[model samples]
Target: MLPISKPDLDAETVYTTCTATARPKSVRPQLQQLTVDLNDAVARYDTAAAGEGLHTLGDLQHQPDGKPDKQPGIKKPKPKAGGLNTHLEAAYTNRLVPEKSPGHGFYEQLMAKAPDGRCPLCSQGVADTLDHQLPKVVYPLLAVAPVNLVPACRDCNFHKGDQAPAAAADQTLHPYYDHNVHDYTWLVARIIEPPKPSITFHVEPPPDMPPTLAARVRLHFTTLKIARLYNPQAGPAVRTLSLNLRRWKLPSSQVPQHLLELAEDAAVENPNCWQAALYTALASNAWYTQGGYEKPWR
Candidate 1:
């Protein structure tokens, strides 16, 4: 998880946008009747989200043992035919946030905060869309709250879709509030060889960090399948390093030193980034830096 600065936009502005052009007939009567003031509704929604952040989204049905059952963490024993979720999905996501609509500009405005336009979740992919910290289906009032929206890459967003935290322990890092990724040495990788060359990633938090935070790191990686997603990409990155060695006419004997320098440069940019973690771990491994490393293909 990468720490991202929250967007400067406000909930009132976004909520107003959603409510402004919504046709009376198009919006559900329940929302119009109950939510007399959009501003108060947004405030209440933000308060609820702050409370929800204290707990992890409950286990999906099969995960009664306190573990999550699948990617994106939807509630177990999924919702039946009809209710508020169904109504909200239709009114909020389908109608209000549609392309070229009045509410769409707010969405675009929030997504523009992503640094380098890269998803802060993985820091490797494009920040193409936004993830609601408190899902829209579960909390319709926050459907367009700027603070609830998090810019993310397609894969990270898909894997984390609509999942709510059941307890504080299960809550994955919120890009805005969770600053561990910015200052901690959490993600680490190792080079794999023998049959082939590959890399594997894992969470290894320092001992001083609280146990709860370390657990969240594990849960985040598990929920997002970060190891599965990141390892394949690391191959190309490692091969590029090998290519650089050959291009510069540097011997394999100097690979360790070169990789250490590369990792240092990356660490200076963002210390906990997956790329930085990869280089740091590679430089520490004798096998990887001393000629076991090889490019699999062109």
Candidate 2:
């Protein structure tokens, strides 16, 4: 996954700034009181997070399904500030996700820092929502913590859910901290011979990476259905390229040049992008470049 820079803004700052906005006369004072309590709750989390990190609040004891149980004595600050939890929960779960609100909403600021607004997890979709690095229910205070919030497409966020890895190998790459994963040649595709040629995708971790990290890469791909999702896209893509070669009546030697262009174009967006890997795989294989692509279309 391509890493994104953590926003300089944190949850507390966002809460204060958001509530300080112009409000209707009816609910203005009430909303201001709730913001105070919400800020206090965030301050408590900040103190607790001083040394252990934000994820420190989520229980390390994971269920068999890989979701960690919420820690005990999980404090939900129930101050007399009437709408505190209401707004706090709403902000964490829903209010912060939409980009329509303009300049300073959490989602907008986060998206501003994204890599061309592409989902880092898939690199194919828009990073439309904020994904909590740790489940918000478990670490409610870190719900808005800058480093803990990631901009992601709905698909990647949904697939990840509240699950934490049961082991190091099960850990999905955290785009912010795991930037190196994108540098490697991980995603790859190959033509599968059959009634018609089609491509299938999978992780092909390089040999030098540690076994654990490699397993993590494979696990990330498997859990996210990277291969399952990417394979379908590859088929139509290969077909299009195959047809183009025929339509243009390109010379055999020039096929590599065209495929290389395809690969390079994809690489410009992400060196390890699926299309780059897919095109590179096709171009590298002698059978495909030598006209294996034309069989299915013609």
Candidate 3:
């Protein structure tokens, strides 16, 4: 996962803005009544998230069909049509996500936070949609909470589904709060040899890192299937690097040094990106540097 600056928005502000133009006039007042409780929930969520305790805050249990087994803290509205859940979800889908909605600016602002529109979750896919860090279905009070909303690619969003963590270590790295993960060189790749020479990415948390933090990194990597998402790109990158090396036609002894330079440059650009990991692995592989890159290793 990649780090991003936390949004400058709050729950009460976003909820009130979204509710201002809530449709079905009857639901407007009901949504309005939830402002205080929703804001409280957001505050608690923020606290728990900072402390990595979000799993403890939600009293609702996950159901097989993505329904919340219970709605705690926030009371259901008078509307029988799914009550507070529907209103809050509509508050997001209708009021916040629509192009001309009052909260569209906030939506854009949140999307803009992702560096170059790349999903922080995968750091590769384009971040076009907002994903609820804690799924809105299970935590309706945070349906429109800006802090709870993260810029994500459609694939990562779909993969995440409506799941919430059952424990602190189970939680995926939060881009805003999990900045420390980026400070280390955990994302690494290994060069697989012949029959089909390809690169595969994996996480290797620093030796001195806390065990729980290390586990969280592994969980984030696995949950998002980072290896599966990165390997295909790594293959193309390996071929491209080989092509470039051939074009340069450097001496065999110089190839590893040239590749190391490329790895250093990629690391400078993005410490944990697939390119950096791939190059680092290739640079260390004597076979690849010593005339092996000339072969068709795609």
Candidate 4:
């Protein structure tokens, strides 16, 4: 996923928008405390270097799974039964819908700022949900924190329900916090030969890469189902797309160590060639897709 900038919104606006439901008196104090904590976190984040600290205010703890942990403590405090606002309920529900129809302005705004008009998670044409980088269930106080919101597709939203981030050395690339992601190229896609009616794909991590980058690549592959066409295998459409035969067919030894650099230059010299090269690489056999090819001798 491309890195994103933090949205320009205030705490009061978010609280009013997200907390329209009535809750118990105990909930009020908890909510207020959360609000204050989030505000302070944001203020600190504004002045820090990129990736200096966890950008969101969610508490970090170990979860059952080996992923980065979050724990949403306490349930909603009981509110007066009749005190909930019907209008607010409607508004909130409308915002939560997964489709990219004419209803939700919040989802639209988030999608407009996302990279390539695609949700990073599902590769869906439109991103209609604002996902929390750190799940709201874990950090209820930061539930409405703008810095935590990310544009996501419905499948991803459902699959990632309240789960923690993958536990690697570096955090998952927060679209807002991590800016240099484009600079790193760790995973490559490739096709598998002897394809049957259905397409098959595979993702491979570059050799000797950092644990965090490898984890991110694996997470993306799983989350998107990049190889799902080979069902019971894993991954989704992009994986199959990688298997298309019209792509690259070269030897690894011939490929240069600085291929990405050359590719960047080619992009500047001839954008079409750059696109072709990338597409070719993606469409090659699973081995080539993951490991890449050596340059050809003319």
The best candidate by TM-score is 3
Each candidate structure's TM-score, on Cα atoms with residue i matched to residue i, is 0.77, 0.72, 0.88, 0.57
The alpha-carbon lDDT assigned to residue 279 of candidate 4 equals 43
Candidate 1 per-residue lDDT over residues 1-298, each given as its tens digit: 6676766776665555565444444444544443444456555544544443434322211211222222355543432232333433334564445787667777777688787898877777889888877666555555665776888888888888766666677777777767654567777887676566677888888888777778888888887777887777787887887777767877877777778788888888777666888888888887766665654533
* Rank ordering of all candidates by TM-score, starting from the highest: 3, 1, 2, 4
Better of 1 and 4 by lDDT: 1
Query: What is the C-alpha lDDT profile of model 4 across 118-138, one tens digit per residue?
Result: 565444336766777666544
lDDT tens digits by residue: candidate 3, 150-260: 999998898888788888898888888787776788888998899878777889988988777889989888888878989778878788888988998889899878877
Q: Give the residue spans of candidate 2 off by over 4 A.
A: 15-91, 94-104
* Global lDDT scores for all candidate models: 0.65, 0.63, 0.81, 0.47
Query: 72-128 in candidate 2: lDDT tens per residue?
Result: 557544323333333434445544554443224666677766688877776666888
Residue 291 in candidate 2, Cα distance off native in Å: 2.2
TM-score of 2: 0.72
For model 4, what is the C-alpha lDDT against the true structure?
Answer: 0.47
Per-residue error (Å), model 2, residue 297: 4.0
**Model 1, C-alpha of 7: deviation from truth (Å):** 2.0
Q: Output the better candidate (1/2) by TM-score.
A: 1
CA deviation > 4 Å runs, candidate 1: 23-91, 94-96, 251-253, 293-298
TM-score of decoy 3: 0.88
